[model samples]
Target: MGGKVLVFGGLRGSAEPRPVPLGDLVVLDPATLEVERVVSGGGGPALSHHGSVPLHDRWLLVVGGWDGRRRLSALHAYDLAGAGGWARLEEEEGGGSRAPHAGLSGHTCTKVSDREGGVRTQRRFASLDTLHVDAAARRYWRNPPNPGRSDEPKGNGRGLIERLSSLIASGSASPRTPRALRHHSMTLVGPFAVLDGGECFNKASDTVCNDLFIYDTRTAGGRWYQLSGTDSEMKRVGHRVLVVGENLCLIGGRGPDGTSCSPEIYTLEINT
Candidate 1:
């Protein structure tokens, strides 16, 4: 079942803030060129730079975002089954509190399907994979590699590794730390998550990366790789990375200097 594509509350830096915390929800019907807005209601305070996911039966799960004054971690749900209105979801303990945690830009949340008689079915589903920038914490958190199910080598080392081993042996799981990422884009490709170009905050040179990294969820290991692209283009942030077939389409985003980059699209072929 397909629904509308609605975008709200993202703007170039210099542009005046949209009069409201949440911008108009732009709705587009997939089968036609028709587009319109449905007023969203009761979703707490207005929010920008937030993360939204379409839940079962046309409900939207709205998470943390910046609301001008401060960052928010309050969870709200919007029902799209009829007249849309927002409802709150209780947050897990130690989860991002009311802090601006990267505002969900460039992250991906995928609905996991259940299997029945060897066929995949999209029933009422929940996200098994979630990626976030966690700007406030300055790191990334992924679902912990399933213990007793993962095949990654439990290596031995003198310092941090040994401490980690002790923690695991005592049945204490490591709390997921946010990764060191800023202005990066992540998309799920099969069992792997691919991260694309964005600046890495380096105090020495303040370098921005045009590099690529792939995190294998199954293996719980990540490796960095470089991409071949022209340097004339400005460094991008808050861009949309959409998976269309086997190609990853890099769509519009703002540059490092807070200027909106000219509308440009790049497609990267994934080697499956």
Candidate 2:
């Protein structure tokens, strides 16, 4: 919420197959363009494509991803306002057999709250596919229980609902959300979330996409609509996107060639 940016697990390299998944947690000062801190205490090996959700003002919950060798469904919590360390999120109230499902990677999870002072999670993305050829899946989970802190959201590692489709069309004329989006980046802006570039398997789509799509969660039936009128169609993968006031800023990623790195950056002005 301040001038800081939090970065979690990701891969570091220009080529594919195995690009060195990273497990370090990093915080950066965007204004100075410098890294302020780095912590490496998460409960697992190095990972990439993990989803993280802010639990509240006090903590952040890091969820499933691929840990280099295998897809991981491990959960870890990081204390932002207190002693900085990682605590593994167990499956049961008193801890039980087998951890929470770890087969989720390349997914998107956002923090959502209700008027009754309860917070839950909303997630949508393709499951972990080394080839990026799986169908996009939507899922939701209720907060577990009270976590001692009045403001902390509890998660018991159960109650996951799968909504197979989120690509509902508003009308036959309305453009549907882009398909074959696995490695995309999404930024929450108010009631809408904007999804940017990502890659698909060469056999499935044979290309990376630079298209932009918007998901509206304000109404009864939420759907994804393709955003039009952008002159720059820059295909990319493994990119980062963030909201700066009313504008959306896109940073570095692999370019159209798939293997080449893109040094150029672009910004899209949002009228909303």
Query: What ranges in model 2 sit over 4 Å off?
Result: 14-17, 41-45, 93-102, 114-174, 201-206, 228-233, 261-266
Worst 10 residues of 1 by lDDT: 115-124
Residues 1-272 of candidate 2: C-alpha lDDT, one tens digit per residue: 34466777676664566787877877877566688888875564476777665544445566677877777666666677655566665443332223354476666555444222222222344432111000111122323433111122233111110110122232322457667566677765555666887775544543777777776665656667775434435777777676543356676667776667665546654432
* Cα-based lDDT at residue 234, candidate 1: 45
Best by TM-score: 2
* Model 2 lDDT, residue 103, Cα: 72
lDDT of each candidate versus the true structure: 0.44, 0.55
271 Cα displacement, candidate 1 (Å): 8.1
Instruction: Count clashes in each candidate, considering only residues at least 3 apart in sequence or on different chains.
Output: 4, 4
Give the Cα-based TM-score of candidate 2 against the true structure: 0.68
